[model samples]
Target: MKQVNALTVAAAVAGALSLAAVTAATPAMAKSVKCYGIAKAGQNDCGNKAGTHSCSGQSKVDYDGGDWKGVASAAACAEMGGQTKPFKGMNPKKKSS
Candidate 1:
């Protein structure tokens, strides 16, 4: 009975530790900001503001202002030449192909 109790406790501890590690490593749970006009062609994270597409990775133009991606933060997105809101045309820094 003592051995069984010890094993059960050990398993419970291991399971808890595993859950903690997974939670810590999950980037999807981290803070993020919506960044526009930075995603490459077919690389947007989700739907476009123009209502052209309803899914991820569907943009037909590189650096299109109507599309967006999930970035680490607003400052980070601005640093990467991205806008917080959707706009018309592509990013001036990039030429459309």
Candidate 2:
């Protein structure tokens, strides 16, 4: 009985130490910014910038200026020729006409 108790306590301590080490070694969440006009068809990360939808995969066209994705860096939006703010996004149907 004594040996069992000692083993249980040792196991508990080891588990707790392992959890603490993992927590300490973990990195923080990467910061992301909203980048518009870059998402492909139905690839928007979240809601539409135009308030047209409240769910993911709601975009109807590719490279929608009104839709955005969470980019890791702010410069990525402009580098991709996209806007960080809402713009007059091109509508595929209307643009084709």
Candidate 3:
């Protein structure tokens, strides 16, 4: 009977800890937003607007305007010169020699 009680307590504690971890992570997840025109070649988080690929990390050019990645916030995305909407060309911020 004592062993059964101890096992029950351990399971309850473990469940509570897992719930606490997920709850603590929720706010950070809520803050994330997709920012286009900022991804480097092969570093995008998901599909591009051009629809040539349907997976992450498939971009063929640096700072492709159609690709995006998750940033901390809209403000952060703008601060980094990224756009909230996808575009049809290379990032305007890219410099040419």
Candidate 4:
């Protein structure tokens, strides 16, 4: 009986540790894009139209960490025509294609 009790406790602890490890090991979702000065898809186009020109405005970015835990913020995306920004700006279009 004593051995069985000890084994059961050990198993429970192991199971809990496995669950914690899995949760902690989960990866966050990250996205990357190419942002040209005036032509791109989904990103804000200075003229208000997207999908054909690079973005040149401001937008909000939302990053989800797979488990629904996420973060969001507003950012400014601007550049000269025919130039690509260091990092692609956020897309503000209702739909991204």
TM-score comparison, 1 vs 4, better candidate: 1
The sequence of per-residue lDDT tens digits that candidate 3 reaches over residues 62-95 is 8888899888988999998999999888888864
Tell me the number of clashing residue pairs for each predicted model.
Answer: 0, 0, 0, 5
Off by more than 4 A, model 3: 1-31
Task: Write model 1 residue lDDT over 24-96, tens digit each, in one string.
Answer: 8567636678899999999998899999998989999999999998888899899999999999999996666
Better of 2 and 4 by TM-score: 2
Off by over 4 Å in 4: 27-97
lDDT of 4 by residue, 1-97 (tens): 9999999999999999999887764442133222333333323423222333233343223210110111121122232222223224433331223
Instruction: Order the candidate numbers by lDDT, best to worst.
Output: 1, 3, 2, 4
Report the C-alpha displacement of residue 34, candidate 2, in angstroms. 0.3
Highest TM-score: give the candidate number: 1
- Against the true structure, candidate 2 reaches a TM-score of 0.59
RMSD in Å for candidate 3, one decimal? Answer: 5.7
TM-score of 3: 0.65
On lDDT, the leading prediction is 1
**In candidate 1, which residue ranges exceed 4 Å CA deviation?**
1-30
TM-score of each: 0.67, 0.59, 0.65, 0.29
